[model samples]
Each structure stands twice: as C-alpha cells, then as structure tokens.
Target: MNADFPFRIVGFDLDGTLLDTSGDLAAAVNHALTSVGRPALSVEEVRPMIGGGARHMLAQGMAATGGCTEGELDVLQRRLLDYYAANIADKTQPFPGCLAALDNLTGRGVRLAVVTNKLEHLAREVLDALHLTSRFDAIIGGDTMGPGRGKPAPDPVLAMVQRCGGGSAAFVGDSVYDVQSAQAAGLPVVACSFGFLQQPVETLGAEAVIDHYDELIPTLVRLGSAA
Candidate 1:
C-alpha cells in the first residue's frame, strides 16, 4: 500500500455523513403526514428514518401516525417528494469540515463519490442546490442500480470503485447499510458518529469511527496503515 494514501477512491453516504439534512427531511415528512391528517414528527425523530431513502422515511413516519395503506402511502410518498424537492436545502448544510475533508482527500489524489439511498434526481437536486455537485466523481442513488441493490448489497460500492477507475477504496457513512456494503465490497469503512444514526454508532461495525470531519483523514490514514 502507498504510505501517502492507501485508497485511491473514497465513497460517502450523502444525507447524514456529508450533509446535515434532517431538518429539511423532517419538514417533508411532516408535509406528507399533515396532508393525510397525521401529526408531524420532530427532526430528531425523523433523522433515524432517513438512511433508507424517502419512501422508507415516509413509511416510518406513517407508521408513527397510525399507519397507511399502500394507496395512502403512495399518495403521501409523492407529496413528500414534491415538497422535499422544492425546498431541498432550506436548512441543509454540509456537516462541519466535510468540505475541507473532501478537499484534503482530493489533494491527496483520492477520488470521491456519494453512494446514497436517495433517489438519483433528488440527490442531484440536493447536491446541485447546495453547489456541491462538482465535488464528487459520481453520485449513485438508490434507484441507480435498479431494485434492491443499494447500500448493504455491495453493488453500489462496487460500482463506485469502477466508476472512479477501479483502485483500492474506502467508504464513509453513518448507517449499518454503509458499513455492511463496504465490508461486502472488501473495503474498510469509517462511520461518522455525528450522523443521523438509526442505531448506536458502536454497532455500525466500521473499521473506524469519527466524530468530526477533522478526524476523517487521520482515521483513513490509520485504516490504511492497518491494511
């Protein structure tokens, strides 16, 4: 392994790992819930529902508000998406030091990509709205690879490596999906403790855990050393 940086490519989970999008997401979910006469959820309550994507988030929200039929869920899901798209970045911003950490990795010749469970266009819209589109080599979304092939399946991570020119890679994310996918892809992972985690960070099973972006590169360096 090269001592400078063992990985040539680094993949990230978008919603929690890169951006603090819980506020906007909670608003969208509340929009849908209100449309169906259900009560709203707090940002803290909605944060854990986010990792699996909009539909999953809505499902969780509806479950909290007396559940819904497939038909009801479908209508609410579309409403949630439309509301979210229109205000994708109202309160969304990069987690502290994420941009600098990206820059640090880029300076080291490490390519970066986002492997999100968000739908492709929504992810693009959110990134574009935040003016962060140019920072990544690729932004693979939940639907990008068809049904059931998002994170935790290893497919998206494998695709990210290929799209970034097929070298050693690592994944940075906050959820079990992220860690599982990286491990499945034979890569090390770093979990972000500050992210909107559904479970406790200790259960993520990543090679390392970081509380801030300032710790990201150093954690990666240590992972590289161990590799």
Candidate 2:
C-alpha cells in the first residue's frame, strides 16, 4: 500500500454509488407491473426503492401501484429480474467522475471491491456489459454471503476485506444498509449525496458526504488522515 494513502482496500456500493442504474431499474420494475396490468412508475418514483435487493424494490413498486399478494410478488420479482438481466446496461453508466475516482484509488494501490445488494449474477452481468468487471478486486452481491447476510449484517463488507487480503479499509455507499454494514465491520464510510437516496443524505450517518465523484478522492484522503 502507498504510505500516503491511509486505506488498503476500499469497498463500494454498485448501483447507486458507482452507477446511475435508475433508468434501467425503473424500466424493469415497470415491466413487471405492466405485465400484470398495473401502472408503471417513473424513474424518479422508483429511484428511492432501489438499494435493497430486487425483491424489495419490486415489493415497494407493487405497494405503490396498488399492492399485491405474496405469491404475486414472487411472480413479479422473477419477471422483474428477467427483464432487468436482459436490459441491465441499456441506460446504465457510471456516475460522473466515477471512473476517474476508481482510477485514482487504483493508482495509489488501493484494492477496490464492489459490495451490492443486487444479485450476484445480475451485478456481474451488468458490470461485464459495461466492461467494468475487471476493475474490481472483488465483486460481492446480495447472494454472495448467503441468505440473510447481505448488508446491514457486516458479512459482505467483511468478505470484501478478506477477499482483498486484509488491511485498513473503508466503504462508500448511499444507503442506511451500507452505513450500518461498514460500521458493523468497524470501517469508516462515505455517503454519496448524488445517489438514489431514500432519505436525507445527512440522516444516513456516514463519516463524510460527497456531492459528486469529483469530491471523492479528497474526502477519502481527509477521512484516512483523520483515522
């Protein structure tokens, strides 16, 4: 690790933090809803429902569009995932300056990992489509750590450290689950103000907040120095 850089491994949340997947995600959700003759939601309306896994987002979508039974949710979730997998990168792209930020960290020899609540195959497929899968040292998904151990449980965050061969670590994300998971794993976390936030960014309780990826390296440096 570079002596000037305080962290050895940095973990990131994929969907909202690294990529702006709201457009494609919203489309997938609408696909499922429309298949059952339900109303479709706007990207804005579906943005906040992201961060959780697909099932959770679809559940929220169903609730918003007039509710559904458990079995209905089960069926819709499959439809949603199928549609999403096929259209994963249709409108998905890195957040502004995100690639630059990743390059900066990698230049400093900081191993990078992606820990997301999205399903593993789906996450990998999308990253593959964008040709970004090679950039990460580890790509852990909601299913990687098994059931009930995705986020807010410290498992995947801990797995990232282990997969990166262990060192001083930090995390970046846009949700309470991300903050809680990193904190539980005893790592400082930065929150993204431009991501799909379900609540006020300030309320997520991250160590630092960056409004744009342009601010990321400096914020991480500051946090590292403080540590």
lDDT (Cα, tens digit) per residue for candidate 1, span 79-182: 99999999999999999999999988888888899999999999999999989999999999999999999988999999999998998899999999999988
> Which runs in model 1 stand beyond 4 Å of their true positions?
1-3
CA lDDT, every model vs. true structure: 0.92, 0.95
Model 2 regions lying over 4 Å from their true place: none
Lowest lDDT 10-residue stretch of candidate 1: 1-10
- Candidate 2 is scored at a TM of 0.99
- The number of the candidate with the highest lDDT is 2
lDDT of 2 by residue, 97-195 (tens): 999999999999999999999999999999999999999999999999999999989999999999999999999999999999999999999999999
Itemize residue pairs with steric clashes in candidate 1.
Answer: none
TM-scores of all predicted structures? 0.98, 0.99
